[model samples]
Target: MAGPPRPAQPRPVWFEAAADGTIQLFTPSDSVKLRRPRRDPRASIVVAAPPGERERRVSVTGQTTVEAEGARDLAERLAARYWDLDERADDLAAMVADELIRIVRHPERVRRFAF
Candidate 1:
């Protein structure tokens, strides 16, 4: 496969799905998770709703592309979603500009389950 190999252990992450259905994820530029995708453009993402509810989840197997140019923009969106970035926009933007990496996954298959 041209994608990243399954990790020895699962690493949970926060992700956002766009209206177009592609998934967006942000991680540190030096993260192992980012390394795998850079080596191989394939990736899989699993997301669960209402945390701790395994039965309600969505899994996406796809191809990923590193989007360095848009990393700062994506980071800003993420910060707005997860934190109060209004007052600290400059700081947050600087941090993301320096260390963040954006991974955009184009879904090949999507599976959802409700149990």
Candidate 2:
């Protein structure tokens, strides 16, 4: 979710890019991140390589929408992708039990550089 525009308001979120080239993330329906985006559809995501890795960065700027569908599915998929859920399956179950909204970003521009 993207924070409101102001001093130091820009932030990063755990988002996944589907094969269709759209970004998706799940957040509680009441998240503060949903507040500003609902007011303004503009948003962006920036990704950088790990600290010890070579310098590579990707940035995407886009318009966003909050949707009611696919939050649980996305959450489940991401949990598995990023975690060894064999020992924490219940944690994922609990997370998906909440009222979530899927934040979708439709990219209008993308920038990438590696050095």
Candidate 3:
């Protein structure tokens, strides 16, 4: 017999490489912090928009290094990459700076699926 399926959750958060080689993650309260997993020091990323029914997604898993930095800066860089806009970069960056932190992970393992 097979078990029930698992629930969907956010996975493979984005993290860019800072001047230094480190990874980062944001807190629910809009605070930047390190998402260092005691068991799994590595990290993974799934860079695809949330899909609806009958949709598909592409993702990759790899090793990661957590970088320690102020939240504000990290958010902006992520926004710029995701949005690809230059104007109001600072403002937009500031908005999510606290929302996300940076993570430096390598593409060691990759997996894709359709739903």
Candidate 4:
């Protein structure tokens, strides 16, 4: 017999690119589902950096690879480089291990604004 459905686990948030080039972020929970959809190369991934008190937005865009795992690791790396936050790949992955539905995206759409 089949086993009971497993409960959803916490996962790191990630943005994805659609065929139309629109961006979408997977919630920490909704990532439990797999085989949902892979990002299209034609599109781009936009990562919005937290704004400072002065008021400004930082965005980065670069080519990305598609993968079904290793999302948290990616997040950690991004955080370190962009946010100057030191994070471990293992711990990052572990934090979202329960909802380890990984997908890779490379940012190609980028923009910034300062006030």
Candidate number achieving the greatest TM-score relative to the actual structure: 2
Q: Which whole-number lDDT from 0 to 100 does residue 15 have in model 3?
A: 57
Which stretches of candidate 2 lie above 4 Å from their native place?
Answer: 1-8
lDDT of 4 by residue, 1-115 (tens): 7566544333435454456554434324454233223322333333344655676664545543445455555455444554434446555555555553444445566788877
Ranking by TM-score: 2, 1, 3, 4
Residue 9, candidate 3: C-alpha displacement in angstroms: 7.3
Instruction: Compose the digit string of candidate 1's lDDT tens values, residues 1-115.
Output: 3555566436866577889888988887887777778877877877777767556888889899888666677777777887777788887867775777888999999999988
**Pairs in steric clash, model 3:** 15-103, 22-66, 22-67, 23-65, 23-66, 23-67, 24-102, 75-97, 76-93
Question: What is the number of residue pairs that collide in model 2?
Answer: 0
Candidate lDDT (C-alpha), each: 0.78, 0.88, 0.54, 0.47
Candidate 1 local distance difference test against the native: 0.78
In terms of lDDT, model 2 sits at 0.88
lDDT of 2 by residue, 1-114 (tens): 866665325775678998989999889988998987798888888889989999999998899989999999999988998889998799999999899899999999999999
Q: Which of the two candidates, 1 or 3, achieves a greater TM-score against the reference?
A: 1
TM-score for each prediction? 0.75, 0.90, 0.44, 0.36
Q: Please give the clash total of every predicted structure, in order.
A: 0, 0, 9, 2
For candidate 4, the lDDT comes to: 0.47
Candidate 3 lDDT (Cα, whole model)? 0.54
How would you order the candidates by lDDT, starting with the best?
2, 1, 3, 4
The top-ranked prediction according to lDDT is 2
